[model samples]
Target: MNPSTFTVMEGEDNERIDQRLARDMDVSRTAIQQWITSGDVQVNGKEIKSNYKCRTGDIIEVVPPPEASPLTAQPEAIPLDIRYEDDDVLVVNKERGMVVHPAAGHASGTLVNALLHHTDALSDVNGALRPGIVHRLDKDTSGLIVVAKTNDAHEHLAKQLQTRSLTRLYIALVHGNVSHDEGTIEAPIGRDQQQRQKMAVTNVNAKEAVTHFSVLERFSEHTLVRCRLETGRTHQIRVHMTYIGHSLVADPKYGRSRSSPLAGQALHAETLAFIHPRQQEKRTLTASLPADMQALLDNLRSG
Candidate 1:
């Protein structure tokens, strides 16, 4: 077992032991709490829970295993389109069909596996299955994603997401020309009672979800639009778009009919913005439409 120790300094009194340990030790609050639960943390030589109030001159110790395995991480040489990289964060333009991380059947060739092969360390806030993942896009929906490399960065970014301070924008192609040039969808999203696998805009076990959109281009049978997310939920844009009379052009399950010739949902994550976790500066990034999506748009424009 590898052991680590930390000393509480002046001005740290009155803070919760777990919180302070998370900040000072560069580990997740959950990780620190786990140590406390296992009697791996002590205050003034006495084992205590994470909620214990910390005082100055307190001595804390933690014992961790020598190595941590990425539960489903397999080293794959999959090429990644890294948009930006810094000491604390990495921005990636994930292609369609690539799972963000491993699940039951998808244990290999995932983005997490790629990350494990590329980088040496990642934050453990979400658990072994998701290392450094701040947010996620659907498997078929491709676009910008931000990953945190350290616990400090993870905490900061997670807080931003919780407070809805992060900006996420997407572009999509939909069937039919929408009547409204721009509008907002203010609906509560919850699990579908009838279809357990999907989300719906109803009050049953629901949370608030908001999306703002503006039409960008119009064709004979399709329209392109830019969308911004105010509240991120599972299938917010997809469900809301379908609810608002313009289901994205290739969504199989929600729309009136599955697309015959078009590819999977025409949505793409086009923009992302947030405060830098370590640098504390505002950061904004954008990704152009993927080739297949652009080709479809071109065909729609010409026809």
Candidate 2:
């Protein structure tokens, strides 16, 4: 997979050196810059800077790197509700009450553990504890999640998420009916200074966060809503919903009315969409709400 060499004639060049090389070689500008930095790209058969202008009669040598497998794939006997799996990625339906990864208070039986058991290869970008975790659902949230199997896959998926190219949608039953049929929560989210355990919309040490939601079903005192995330932040959905005066039903920490029947928050990650890391095509994955949450909603609707 090494890049091929090219001869630049005096009167045929008409673009920036990097752009020209990228177009001529069918590569990316970033890749061309990388070659220049590594001294593998040269003008007139000699090493040149990335910004070097091309002249007529210049011989350009491009040494493309060898294509190697991104990581080692291993198979382990871990139980998983696999929604999708390919050479570069996987999708899993995470059950309600399942932690994404192991933490101090909890270890083993986590989604990571299952992944390790199910597949041997996962991107090391997030370290050993988290192999392929690009985005995360809360410990109590159940839904579909995409996982990367290699470094290239990890980088590609991470970039999509950072650029807001990915779509994450959730369904939740809140304590009260919303006043509006649809609304957007354009609020910044940051760590709570007073309480480290909570996230809040504040000006200090914050990042931009936005949530768009529409009502799905309305109960006498509860509302089921579908929320889409435009920006990812820690505890984003929970925090934004609480800030807007309708905390998720059964969320003990944020509930205002306090007449709770469920043991945990009634939230579910219903759908996720992103570009395929290897195929470069868009893909969407979905999952049904866990039985407990579904039953809770049913009971709410009936009562």
Candidate 3:
């Protein structure tokens, strides 16, 4: 097994080794705890427990566990709004409420389940549970997503994502009027320690994340903004906007309680652009605002 090494920085002193490593590695704490239990994590070349306190000069080594067997995802008869499709890849306009892939409580009715039924083959780089899924959108945020049909295509798209060459643009209605016409949020993002279910702008074991946004329109109590992602961390846009005191309209997790016609956040993945893996050409796909988001905008305008 290949091992990764890190030095505990002065700022990380007294932090639990597992927690520090998980934050620095951008992985789950649970995964790091398992590694500690299995003797896969060492401090100064000695196996350490999960709660081992770190010193400023400590050297840590981590050997990741082997991949588990792939989960079998069953096909479901879920309808899809396919925007573009080719032998190499498929671009889909996912609805706001649809989960991208299955997980604990969401075992079916996901985009993966729909794709399985619609296509005979999908790139297995992400395993069976998320076959062909190159990226993801939150369940309450609707937008365009690309799926790979083959391993080569998956590798190409994934590489584009890593290089920040793929363009991901989103449209959101935020809860407050944005004063700046355009701005960028550059912050480190990590899972919230207090609220484990949420992502937060944190420096602890966090990754660099950037979101660029411009105001599209202004309302009395809200602003419509266009956000372009330079890094695609989970909930990057949402967290960044909230950090600036402009959470999305109707956002349950980050926004203040208010009355709204919408059931979820007013966020949408409106555009996706990437170099085609097979055709060797640039491809850009867009999805219009879904009915619910559009309706919210109309309501705001009419008031």
Candidate 4:
């Protein structure tokens, strides 16, 4: 097993060892505790319990166990809109209403299943659930996503995401007329404790998220806008827009009561740019707004 090391900083002082490790390593606290029980975690060259309070300037080492066998997900013959492809990566213009990968309730007919059928190999860095998936678009949001063909490619793409070098832009039709031409939303996002399925701007275990947007067009009750993500967070644009009193036109999770002509959120990932892992070159790809979104704009223009 490849052992990892970390040093507890002053900001992390007094935190439980397991919690500190979980936050720093982006792993589960339960998993860290398990490693502690197995004597695979040490602080200053001595094994410690999970509940031990960490002090600043402490050196920590973790030797994680070997990963379990990869889970098997059957490949399906679902159609994919391939935008670009090469040996190390593939860019797909995913359609709206298509789940990006498999989950407990959605175990089939996902983009992963389709990709498995289309390609013979995929990076397993994200484990079985999301092989080759460097990032994701919501099921209702359509647009470009890049898939990694090998582990090295996956790591490179993931580093771009972490460094905020990966560029993602979206086009959305939101409820209400936006007054400003452009603005930025800077908020921390975390899961809602009351409603586990929802995310909110909360301080508790929240991560910093920033979204910049510009108004493209205005209508009587809606506005078309372009958004660029500075820091990717789940449902960030949707949540931020809603927080600013301009939820998406048809976002069932965050929109007003009036049903929309479109079935889901009128949001599309319009552009994606990233540095290629193998080629060491920058690549930017774009996808046009889906037919439904375009039709909605046309209707607004005609009226």
Whole-model Cα lDDT of every candidate shown, in order: 0.82, 0.79, 0.86, 0.86
Per-residue accuracy of model 4 over 103-182 as CA lDDT, tens digit each: 53566889999999999889987656578988888889989999999999999999999999999999999989999999
Candidate 2 per-residue lDDT, tens place, 147-173, comes to 999989999999999899999999989
* Cα lDDT for residue 111, candidate 2: 89
Give the residue spans of candidate 3 off by over 4 A: 1-71
Which scores better on TM-score, 1 or 2? 1
For every model shown, what is its TM-score relative to the native structure? 0.76, 0.73, 0.79, 0.78
**With candidate 4 superimposed using the best TM-score fit, by how many Å does residue 9's alpha carbon deviate from the native?**
21
Local lDDT at 279 for model 2: 81
lDDT of 3 by residue, 150-224 (tens): 999999999999999999999999987899999999998876879856889997657899999999999998999
Off by over 4 Å in 1: 1-71, 260-262
Best by TM-score: 3
Of candidates 4 and 1, the better by lDDT: 4
User: How much lDDT does candidate 1 score?
Assistant: 0.82
> Which 10 consecutive positions of candidate 1 have the poorest summed lDDT?
64-73
Question: Considering only N, C-alpha and C atoms within 3 Å, which residue pairs clash in candidate 3?
Answer: 23-205
